[model samples]
Target chain A: MEPIKIKLDKSNELLTDLMPRKFGPQGRLWVGFLLLVIIIGAVAYYRQLKHGLVVTDMRDFTSWGIYISNFVFFVAISLVGSLVSAILKLTNVAWRTPLVRISEIIAVAAITFAAIIIIVDMGRPDRFWHLFVYGRIQSPILWDVIVITTYFVVSCLLLYIPLLPDIAVCRDTAPASPRWKKRFYTFLALNWKGTSKQYAIIHKSINVLAVLVVPLALGIHTVTSWLFATTYRAGWDSSNFGPYFVAGAFQAGCAGVIAVTFVLRNHYNLRKYITNKHFDNLGKLLVLLSLIYLYFNINEYLVPGYKMKTVDGEHLHSLFRGSYAPLFWSVQIFGMILPIIVLLFKKGRKPLPIFIVSILVVVGAWFKRFLIVIPTLLHPFIPIQNVPESWHHYVPTWEEWAITSASLAGALLIITIFVRLFPIISIWETTEEKMNATATQTGDQTQFYGA
Target chain B: MDEEQSNSRRSFIKTGLITGAIAAGGLGIMEVASQDTSKKKGDTVKLLSPDGKIVEVDSSEINPQIPDSLISTHNVREGVPGKKFVMVIDLAKCKNAGRCKSACSKMHYLPETRSYIKINKMQDSDKASPYWMPTPCFHCDNPPCVKVCPVGATFKLTDGIVGIDNDRCIGCRFCMVACPYSARVFNWDTEYQINVVRFKEIKEHAACSTHVTGTVEKCDFCPTKAAKNELPDCVQACPNGVFYFGDENEDVVSNGDETVRLSQLLKDKSGYRFLEDLGTKPRVYYLPPVDRQFPFKDVEPGTT
Candidate 1:
């Protein structure tokens, strides 16, 4: 086992040091941009609700659109909490300490957005309670509700438990902050005194939660996939769906973390904390995920492509050579293949290039979900007849676009607010690592050193 | 004796005596009536059952009331108590007449795009002869839609008719996706605005769309009409008696003009189901379109 050691370090920062700091000019501008986009989306959604789903291009043939894809994206991004915090902790990977809190915050924000977006997709948003009142245990959607709630609980505990010590550090060190803010931090700190017993209990609880969260994460995405797979539609009906969706989820999640890391590294001058090394490692993980996703993508499409089964053939043709072909091929190449190719090389794995590539993978992945849901529905085994010609096709209206955008903005705003309150990179964990490195360099150096 | 029971017995005897007296005089009147209206309605006659019970009724009266029992929607869905609702479409009689489709669409108040019944133009293989097959909700015994509806909004009825409880639906449309037959439709918008007078008049007979914009809708087998003990509008409307609806329990089905035993019809006509390999156990059956009564052109584009 690695050497076990515990040492006390005091941080006497004031509350102002921990409370929300005002954004700089550039930060304000960035937030303003996201807000403007969100507002536009909101206005669009208002029209949709008033006029009905007719605002969007989506028709009976294409009942779902960009909104469902966005929902899938949020659900995918939420998986990072389990991967970074729970899985890493259970595996005893020490390097993951700095990333655990960041990943958990991202997880909470993404999942919250996921829940919201699903409701937005409803025809009668007011009937939301019907799901609970009449919920069937057999439905995959209900399973999703149950498992996601469980995941949210475990993730919140994991995030909160680790923050107690850090909250104590901020509480004491940041006393110059406003009185109310100070009280808030102090309460959140849970009077952590760094005792051996307290540390042991915290560690044990975290370990237990960590062990439990991975499967719940797997369950959430698997159930989401089952929503489509359980259907008899040509593209969605496949046993390969569970793993295919899981792989795509991890790929999207890893790219999201990369994007967030790059932005934080540049804005906060977190070079020492979120180093090039971190970027390179995350890039390698992204590549592995993209490759795995590619494998599943092949199975999802190519096997069906091979036989061109009578029922499945028309759906496949639409994806391969019809209206959706451009988007389909783009997602395959840019979302999975290109990212995998670029990340394989040393230069391409650098922070800047990986950031560009991550954005592509994420955007491309969103469109991939759109393709997965819509094309198959349009090609029901029977011919499109008897109904109006418009019913034969689907186009989403402006309101759908607005609501979908607002949901995205809402996710980002939560992340922004969280960062304003707490440092994106864990300050306490960084300090501890620095202290350990120093101790190793000088065997008897047990004193604090000013930066 | 209970007052209700004694009153019912009294009325029964009175009706019997009046019927016997009418029968005695009806024979003399029938001879003259038959000559006057042979094409319209033939003579009325007094009849005795094979079991030696005497009951006076017209020849047409026996068959007309025979259809009455099957017409009741409450009884239709309960399916003659022990009977299962089943259909057998004779392909030979179908040249895509589309009478079934139009009757279903108009009766259900379906959105112009949504269809409860579909007429598929199919050829099993390039070498096989082409035929037009009309499809309705199979109302499968083992329905995939029932299995995946998270809200229990869509369910399989006892007599093998799948149904939806619109009030409880969350509009998730999971059932629409789950159905292999593509029988479901989501109400994307309120199809029409309702007027109080019109709504009240139609309310008891057909759906008054309290159309929750996102919930699903599909074929309901004319349950409301069946309650009145009348033939389903579709069965009555079809010029070609292509659709034969009956109870599997009672082993009989009719199209108002013709009645046949359900088992004999299926066995003799070589009826089969759609997608039988999936084991959905569809309540609907099809008769092969080998010698169509109407040519393929009878479908007449835009009629549907």
Candidate 2:
């Protein structure tokens, strides 16, 4: 209690600043918009279900369309949880405290939609249970299913264990919260008193999950990449797909975190908590990830471009100077190259500019996934035959657009609701970081405290 | 005693006639012929029933129904055992008449837009001569489609026929993507493509398993015809005798009219499988369009 009194004033300030707050009119409007988008998407999905996939423009040649691209986007974005939370946490990056919770929320939401969008792409979603009942171990798709589920569980544990103390804080500090919210906090807090034993268990559990999540995260995206790479198609036949996907996922994920943190900072008035330094550090991280992904992109495309094997030539020709060239170059330039160029500057790392760049990175990543799945399918080894000329090209139907938009909105809804219910930043950990920072600067050994 | 036995036999015949009339509306001429009491005909055939007892009946009385076992789901996946099926397409003979495509589509009840076989007009390069290439499922020995099928719905049978069980297919289209030949097509809106009457007709055929609405469909190499030692529809329907069907195990193939040794034909013609470098081990072979039966000048290179 003596040490508590010493740190009480600073800790209370953190609690007041970082605690979850009621949404204002603007927040309510945002939630309403997300809900409306989700409803529209659900209605589109219903039509797709009623009329089969024909409602979409997916034919034989362009069999896989934007739904698959959307699935890849969700999976790629979800990897942010593992990158920011598990990887940074293990590396002892102290600045990650405020970003970890947001990353985890994005991960959970994106992954949940990823699973949904894949089902949406299926010809027989009613038989989705067959994936489990009759799933074969040999298929890369089964491997993706297994690892994604594992990653989801590990990410949830990682998000939840650290949240126990915060939930307890909400329970004790906000008595005016709804009775259901109080009951929820009380149940989830697991009676956390912030005692030495509770803190020890929480720390140990988080460390284990953080360690476990790294391989699982890598496995999920790598398996997803293998879904394309394991096939004999031109664009997807590269051996570099696994690492290429993982690297691109990291880039997309970091961009996602930047965008989300920017929104949270402005909306919740959390500018002091998520300061410029976090953006600067994140900007640097984004550049490193983008550079790595750019390297992989070279490995993925350059060899095939050089070899120019007949089938690979057709696929590369399409991607380079054919129908898909515009998209391919745009994704490369905007998603990878431009982000690297812009974020290298200090001024570009500011919140507003970084947010704008992040949007580009994220949108480009979505189209990048589209380019990955569709172009390879169009340029099969054999020439396109007597099928309809339209089959040779793909244009997503209104149903496809609606459904894909819905999934994105669904992910945003999850993140928005999570921000409403829980502290977007980890309160207890941020306070600890503050206390340590204060002690170091003042050179006062007596002010140091341990949980 | 003889009179009593004859009277009882007559009564049995009368009861059978009444029941048969109820079941089949009216007896055919054959039934009347077999039941002719005026002629003392004594041609009897013995048949076994479900009870495992052999009963004697007149040969004309035996109107056979197709065995229930033939249409069972298990037989569809098992395929014709002890036979390794293969096909050889002579590119020189093909003029892209499109009869093979129509024959295949009609037999499989495929819609006008879809076909189990496609006559691709192929030319290796600007210098190379154009030829009509009728392509079907290769039924590859190391099938990429089978390897990637997550549910084991589409599988390679021991008889060298790659078959798809539409009931088991989840319609993920992974198999469609995995097929390098572009042989697979999804039943995107099968209900509209194939009507209800034709759907039931397809179900009765063991080889051409009726496609589900959201599942995959492809050329199954006409396993139903092959099981009966008959040529596949495409092989039989080709006007120029382009397609040759055979059992690789027997080493002989026939083009409806002409029979030749598979090994000898390949040796003489220098036949090769498509995309041999891919190592798919396709069952469909091609004889180079050398010594052309139809000149490359006749058909435009990219038209049909």
Candidate 3:
């Protein structure tokens, strides 16, 4: 009761400030727009289903189109959950409390869509159950399926465990206007009383989940890379793909966090919680990730470019100066190198500039996946032969465009709904951080949180 | 044939090949099935049913107009047991005559836009000669395509043919990407592309190998023909005898007219597999384009 009084006295301001609020007019508009996009995507997917994947421009030569790359993009960005929450949490970064929930939201949204887009790309989605019924352990795709499911589960638990206290807070503090919303909060709150035992369980569960997510995150992206690397395709035939894809994923994920954080910060007026300092720290982290990604990119492309073996040469040529050159170069310069260069300067790491840079990084990350999947497919070992002229080049039709756009929009919608339903930041953790800072002089916080 | 003429002929085949057995109340099926187009086919087909019984079927059963209960997945995965089929393409004799492509497409009921084989006009370098290398699915012993199939949809049969069970295929196209030879083709918009040519349903039957709407299709090495102890459509249809198909266990290959010892032909012609460095161990071997049969020329797939 004494500790309750202390927590109440300190966190009264934060509880009211951080409790979930109703969306503004702009927020409603945004949600409506996402719904519309999702509907359009649904229609497109329906058409694609009714007809076969031939609705896409994917032919024999370019059997995989933007749907695959978009799936890769979703997987890549989904890594943000582990990188921001798990890595930063384990490293004892005190500032990571405010960012973890957003990263998890993004991870959940993006990973959910990652699974969806893969099914959309499937030729026989009706037979998707066969992957489980008759799945081969030897196949890299099955490995991708296994790790992706595991990562999705881990990410959900990571997001949920940390959210229990917040859900309880929302349940207790929420205005009882909507009965179902209150019931949702109550059901998800899992009867949390915020006792020392409850807190202990929360902390212990979070630590385990955080530790478990790192490898699953890395494994998901690595297995995804193996889907290509296991093949002998010229561009995908490297041993470097696993680490390379992991590095690129981290880079894209970090940028995704920053970009979404910027939007949330502006839209929700969360500047006080997500400060300039947070942006600067994230920018610095993004720089490190970009440098690591650039190193792997060089290793992935340079050695092969240097050797220029016949197959790799044809593949690399298509990337370097061929049809894909402009995209490949732009993704390199803007996605990895530019972010590294821009974020190196302290001023550039500020909120506005870094937000713009993060947008560029995200867009470039998307096209980067395109460059990875498409150009290699076009340059298989056998010469492109007497197939129709249309098969020679892959141009994704509107159906593909609609579906991809919808998935992206669907992820945004998930995040938006999550923000509306709960506080975007970890309310309990943020209050704890505040209490820790304020009670340091009195040494009163140690007694309550020390366990 | 005119419209009425072709319709009447197809019904004649339907009754003569299958219903004629029912007309006789299921007695003496073999004799009744052989009443019409069977003798014209010149070879009788021996079908192994789902249960292990080798019964003689009329060759007229190969007709496309029959309602599509193509091949049993349970039966053909083991393939004509003890026979490891092989193909040898003599690069020397190829003049880019595309009868093989047409015959294969016609046999497989492929549309005008797609074929199982492609005659690649390959030039080694500026200094070396260009050759017409017709590439089909190699049915490699160490097949990259089969290894990557997540659902065991495409598999290597005991007869050295890589069979695709389209019923089981989830159509991820991972096999299509895994193949180095670029041999696999997706049935992209099967309903549309098939409607365009009005080709009959694919009856290639490399063990449940009918072209499902959203699955992978490829050169199944004409396992259906081989099941009947005949050369593949490409081998029989090649005008210049450039394509030789046979059995490796038998160590003999024939180009419809000439039978030769497989080892002797490879030894004399310096036969080798294409892209041998990749270690795919292809069932198809190639004798280099030397001592030219006709001058090397660039040719389209459906052109002379």
TM-score per candidate for chain A alone: 0.90, 0.95, 0.95
Best by lDDT: 3
DockQ of each: 0.43, 0.46, 0.53
DockQ of 1: 0.43
Stretches off by above 4 angstroms in model 2 are A1-11, A438-451, B1-68, B71-74, B192-204, B297-304
**Model 2 docking grade:** acceptable
The residue-by-residue lDDT of candidate 2 on A72-173, one tens digit each, is 889999999999889998899877888999999999999999999999999999999988998999998899889988888888888889898888877776
The model with the greater TM-score, 1 or 2, is 2
Lowest lDDT sum, 10 consecutive residues, model 1 chain A, at A1-10
Which has the better lDDT: candidate 1, or candidate 2?
Answer: 2
CAPRI-style docking class of model 3 based on DockQ: medium
Superposed model 1: Cα runs more than 4 Å off = A1-20, A173-179, A439-451, B1-81, B110-115, B193-210, B298-300
Better of 2 and 3 by DockQ: 3
TM-score of each: 0.84, 0.88, 0.88
TM-score of 2: 0.88
**Least accurate 10 contiguous residues by lDDT in model 2 chain A:** A1-10
lDDT of prediction 3: 0.83
Considering every candidate listed, which one attains the maximal DockQ?
A: 3
lDDT of 2 by residue, B1-304 (tens): 5335444644655576657753432233234325444344467878874356998987645432222223322255665656899999999899888778788777877665568787787888999987878889999999999999899898998779998878788989998888889999888874734454555445435457465789988898787677667898888888899999999987879999898889989999999999898788999999999988987545533233
